[model samples]
Each structure stands twice: as C-alpha cells, then as structure tokens.
Target: MITINEAYVDSLALNAAAVKNGRDLVKKNKITKRCRTEDKTLLFGDCQGSGKEPYRCSVDYLKPESPVYRCTCPSRQFPCKHILGLLYASAAGQTFSVEAIPQEIAEKRDKADKREEKKKEAIGVGSDEAAVPKRKTNKAALAKKINAQLEGVELLDKLIRQLVQNGVAGIDSKVLKMMDDQAKQLGNFYVPGLQNELRELILLIKENKDSESLYTEAMDQLTYLHALLRKSRDYLTSRKQNPELAMDSESGLEESIGHAWQLSELRDYGRVQAHVELAQLAFRSNLYAARSEYVDEGLWMDLSSGSLYVTRHYRPVKAAKYMKEEDSVFDIVKASELFIYPGELNPRVRWDDGPLRSMQAEDLERIHSYSRSSFTEVIKLVKNQLKNPLSDKHPVVLLRYSEIVVGEDDSYGLLDAQGKQIVLQDTAYLAHATTHLLPLLTPELAANQAMLVLFEHELSSGRLIAQPLSLVTKREIIRFIY
Candidate 1:
C-alpha cells in the first residue's frame, strides 16, 4: 500500500493557484466519494464547480512516479482541481476505505491502456524522438503594423500642431465635426488609444463649461496626448527598424496603441508574481464617455512586498446592466499568482477569484507597517514620476500621519510628525466628498491614523494635492467613495 500526505499532494501540483483552490474545495466539503481501490492504485472523487453537476476525476498510481490523472472537466490541466481536491481529502486523513473501481472508470482505463500499447508498438520501443520545429515570428506582419502605427502617430502630431496654431476660441460645430471625423480616422489606422484621447477633448468642449476651465482642460489633455504620441512614435520607429526589439517593454507603449496583452506574454516577460497577498484599500467606478465603457477600478496593496496594484473590469455601456459590479472588499485577498500589466506607479494586477476570509489584527498591522509616514518623501516620489508627462498624473498611496490640520484658508492638510504638511483636495474627476466625512470622524480617530489617498499634481501651480478615499482607524476603515 502507498501512503499519501499533504506534502506529497502539494509537491504534485505544478500550478500553485490550482492547488490553493483545490484546498478551498475540500474546506467547503465539495469533495465526495473519495476512495481508493483495494489494490491501492487508484483514488477518485467528484467536485462541484460553478454548476451543480459535479466533475468526475480519478488518479491512477500503478506506476507512482508517472501517475495518470483523468478528469471529465474541460480544463486541459492534468490532475485538475477536482482530482487534487480528492487527493487532498485523503492526505488530510479523510475517510477513504478499500473499494472496487467503478465499471465506467475501469472501462476507460482499459481503452487508455490499449491505446498506449498501440502507440509503443508503432514507435518501436527505444527509438529517439525527432526534434520539433521552433515557431518563429512573422517579421513581415509585425513590420506592417509598426508602419501603420507610425503613420497614425504622425497624423496625430499634425492635428495637435494645427489646433495650437488656430486656437480653440473657434471650436464651433464645424470644428467639432472635423475633430470627430479625425478621431475615427485614427481608429482606422489601428491607434484607437489616440482616438479616445482626441474624443475626450471633444467631450470637454461639448460639456459647455466655463471657458477658462475648458481651455485649461483642453490644454492639459492635449499636452498629455502630445507627449504620449511623441514617446510612442519613437518606440514604434525603434520596432520598425528591429521588429523584435522587446516591443512591448518600453513603458507599455505598444499597449498604448491598442495592444491587448495576454497572460502568457506577461509571464514570458517576467511580469507575473507568485503567492501575492493583497488588501483592497479603495475602489471606484467611472464612465468613459469616449469609449462607451464603465470601468470598475480596485486599488490593492501587496502586504508582502509593500507594492500597490490595481484591478480593472471594463464593461460596455450597453451591457453594463447585465454585468455585476466588483465592489469594495474589506477582507485580505490571497492569490497564488498575480498577473501584472504594463504601467507605472500602480501597474494593474489580476488574479483568479476564490474564497476570502475576514482580516485579522495581524493583517492590519501589516498595512500600518507599509504606510508612508513622511509627506516630504512621498511628495518627492510623486514629483519624480509626474515629471514624465506620459506617467500616471494621479497615483494613490497610504499615508500615516500625526494629525489632520486646517489651513488658514480652511483647506485640509495632513501633518506628519516633523510638522511638514501635505494638502488634501479633490481629484480632477471627483468632488470633495471626503471633506464632508472629515467632520464626522472623531478627533481621536483622525489623529495618529492613516488613510488611502489619491495624489494629483496641479500642473499650473506645481502643487501636489491628495484626495482621501478611505479613512483608517484602529478598528475599521471608513470609505467615503465607493
């Protein structure tokens, strides 16, 4: 008879995430019929996934070193979570008595054995295998894309220069139509990212706000777009000369031109991290009128590495009613793998959903330990990143402070231990809702505490301002914005 333990079962799982999920199945009592054959060569059971119909799975260990795992699940992964869950049950000393193999499984094993025997006979037992051909990149296709993108960026540059020369005082209906038409043209050239930015400028004009504020918004949007275009065009030209020169690695310029990266590609570029633990510090849902989509943004902090990550779900405006929103999560999330996207500051992260438990005191301590205590240092970091026009203008962080103070003009600022002050203000797109919540907080909780803040740099005044999203006390977190 063979003996199975937790260590042995864990060692068998190549995908750590799958193993963790399998553990959850066991904890939920989803595994059933967990038993082994009298010969001790088989282990089998059933596990419920999303649907009520349980997936059937079995493991054949006639040759333990080369165990054969079978499952009815659609997953191509061997020893699917169902099988792992069954084995985990047994490893945890769950009851598994000697039993006969089911007739269906027995028949399947016989057929598999016959097929294996036929393959061995056809291959003539000890012959060396032929080397497989390595798949190569089609340089012609990639070069063509790079050329189209470069042309599109050049067109954008011409449009911006014209807008500057003519000025926006004449942004009437005729001018709006021309801008709209140009946005569509950019889309046709495969630079939809630029199209969205251009349409955003159009949307600002149509909002019919104060002229001065409109001019400021237009100037800022165009400046960022102009900088983004110049940087991406240079990157595309570099790829045009050397088609395989780490194209997507240049500050995610390729993605800016509408390249949707796959998880395998991110993993190949060493962007995926294993065993990531995150806490959702804040969340928000925003509508992008230009793109016709609603984006649900979740801000998460990595407790292990003290890193910030963001998760986004883009729902089309037409289908948004049918799609459920991913709202705030108060518990700590543990994920075996976190897929990292290309961006700066808070690069987007994604992970498979699973069961989560309520956070404990230890988790709170970890959050407090990772917070920034010095406003000066945090400002310096934000300034450095904001200097790059292409970088994220609004970056978020957790700030621990000695007290919250009111300025001479009734403005809010966070006071650190050394008396340095960081102003609190609203984000460009959001209202000052956090201000209303400030008065509601007790003085004891407001002093020597922490909060989740989104920092934005005022381009005209060069002042770094923050918007509080959530207030953290010793007991619980109060979120002003959802």
Candidate 2:
C-alpha cells in the first residue's frame, strides 16, 4: 500500500475549494463500503453521496508522483471531491484490507501496461541483449522533396522581387491577396514557418501603410525573407549530399523556414537532461477557421551548462482549457532535471519525470555567476545574435540598471551602468516595473537605483526592444508573464 500525504492531496486537488470539500467529506465519515487496496498499487473506496448509490472512487498509485484518479461521481473537475476524500482517508492511516482487484481497475491497468509496452517496442526496447536497428531512409524520395522545396523558395524570391519593384505605397488589396495566396502555396511545400513570415510581412504592410517607417519595416522583412530563402537552399543541398549531418546541430535557417523535428525522435536520439531556470514565459491563443491554437512559450536558462533553451507546448483551444486547470509549465518554480530537446544555440525542453523541487542557494549562485554583468557585453551579444536571420528572440541579461526612465508617452527605458540603454516595449513589463519595481525603491535608491533584469531583446525597424523576464529590486524579484 502506498502512503498518500497532505502535500500529495494538495497537488491532486483542482483548487482550494476542492481540497476543502474533499477534506470535509473525509471528516464527516462519508466514505463507506469495500475500501481496500489491491496489488499494492490500487486503492478503492465507496463514498456516500447525495445520489441513491455511493460513488465509486479509486486511485492508481502505480506512479505515486503522478497518480491516476477515477470516480463514478458526475463532477467535471478531475479526480472529483469523492476521489480526493478516498485518498484523504488513506493518507490518514485508515487501514484498507487487501482485496482482489476489481475487473474495471484490472482492465484499466492492463490497457495502460499494453500502451507502455507498445511505446517501448516502437522505440526498439526489447531484452537487454537486443539491439535497435537503424531507421531506413529513402534517399531518392528525400531528394525529390528537397527539390520541390527549392522550387517553392524560387517562387517566393520572384514574388519578393516583384513587391520591391511595385513599392510599398503601391501595394493594395489585390497585392495583399496575392501574397496571402502565395503564402498558402508555400505551406503546400511543408514550409509553414516561411509562410508565417510572409503572412507577417503582409500584416505589417497593412497595419503600417500610412506610417513613416512603412518602407523601412517592409524592406527589413524582405531582406530577412531573402536571407532565409538562400540559407534554406544551401541547407537542403548539404543535407541531400550528406544525410548523416546531425539535424539538431543549430540549423537556424531550416527552423526559420518551418522544418520541424519530431519530439519523440528527439527524445529518443538527442535528449539533454539538465536543471534550468525559466527566465521568461508567455501564452498566446488564436482562433482560426475550424480550430484555435494555444501556445505556451518559455525561455529557460540552464544553470549548469550556461546555455539558453526555449520550451513550447501547443494544443487545441479545447484541450488547452483542460490544461489550464492543472499546473502550468511556469508552476515548476524549482531546480530539477528537465529533458531538453536538441539544438545548438536555442534548444527546447520539457519537465522530466519527477516532483517539482525548489531551487537551492547554490543554484541561484550558479545562475548569477553565469549572467553577463556588463552592459557592453550585453550589447555586443545582441549585435552578434541579430546577424542570424532567425534570431528574432535572443535572450540577454542586464545585470544591473543604473536608471529607469519613464518617458512622456508612458513608455519606459532602462540604462545600464555602462550607459547602454534599451527600450522596454512590452506593455506588461512596463506596468510591472511601474507597479512593482518602483514601489520597492528607497528615496535614495529611487534617485539612483540599480535593478537587475533578465530579458529577450530584438531589433525592430532599427530600434531595440526589451521583453522583460524578471526584475530584481532591493526587496524582491518580480517575474512578468502574459
């Protein structure tokens, strides 16, 4: 039998109300008949409810850290109050006589085991002596695919040249429609990322049609597109010639042009395990014709490796709703080993199989030690990153800010000790600075306060903008997320 504690109960509850209601049920002795444990993995109980029959509750403790909960109660909340009550009673040291597993529970365990076995088999896990075979690749088929992609790139190049000749002022509804149509065509060639870039260019043109920097912004995007097209051609050629070249070796151009690596494949072949700090996080949702897209993005800094990683979780809006009710990726406010997907400059990662653990003082020290302290260093790094066509979101650390200037238009800017300044363009970060950071200042410090901040910086229309990750004042550190 597994020991369930209050910490485990709190983790399992949907919210504070659920915890209270479940504890109330347990205190009132609502749980009844046939409460037992089976195979040291399953716990079950009958709980009295308002209905004629008692609700059936069970907790599969096979994976104690991530228990599988089940109940017959008609509650939308996961695990329901009755399930929580059952676990609460078990945690309170209530003895459960050993019993044979019910057919329902047995079938569930069997199904779960079968699924796990199949996944292992797919990844070539057999007896210890068995060796996994290399995955077969059809070189001819791959060559044909690359050739088709190159054709799409050529078409994009022609469209870009035509747009430049027409001038930004001459672009109208018809031109915008043509670009949109061509972007859709690019998607047909498995280059959705490039298609996205094209769509963004069109949007930028439409939104800033009357602005003074319209021409500059349009040209910047066009230049980026041209570089991406050229780089993709080169990458594809090299990949076709040498199929053994590591795909995860920081092919920024390939990723920029929408080539993606399967997460399962990366986990099997190129996983990097480490403890990293989440420097920044953001979530965005968009409704399309048939479905909505939900994306969770995080900028993680590995304390041990001194490398930056970007982690993303995407789901349909309906599925996202369910996910929101549970712990978010940001909830892991601890130092724990995570499974990082492979990439040279900016890899992606996810939480590993363990309970979240808090960061130690040593972990914080390691992070501080690795941070770029000087403004000059930060500026140099930013300039170098901007040279990469796909370096739209490059991470930077401003170890200390010499001044925080609030502009007349309510915009904010930060000046480091070395006199380098960066504009804070994110409205959320500005609000956080005003509401949280400013109040923490002493009269003297407010006049000449030094603040530490982690941020992602990007160049837009010849201006640098900073999206704040965290701000450190004398009293506290505030993390901003949207």
Question: Model 1, which residues run further than 4 Å from truth?
Answer: 1-135, 459-462
Candidate 2 differs from the real structure by a C-alpha RMSD in angstroms, to one decimal, of: 6.0
lDDT by residue for model 2 (115-206), tens: 98987677554344222234566778877877787788788989988988888778889998998889778877867677778887887887
Instruction: Please state every model's RMSD to the true fold in angstroms.
Output: 10.3, 6.0
Task: Give the per-residue Cα lDDT of candidate 1 at 42.
Answer: 91
Best by TM-score: 1
lDDT tens string, model 1, 1-482? 34688876776664577779779889999986677898889988777878878888888876553577888889755566788898889888898877899899889889978997975455333333311112256899988877888888999889888887888787789989988889889987788888888988999899998888888889889898888898888788887888657646537566667787766566556666767778888888888799999888999889898788888998888876445456778888877668889888788888753345578877777877788898889889988988887777788888999998887888888998999888888767664467756767788977998888998876557678899988776566778887
Error of 2 at 111 (Å): 5.4
Clashes of 2: 0
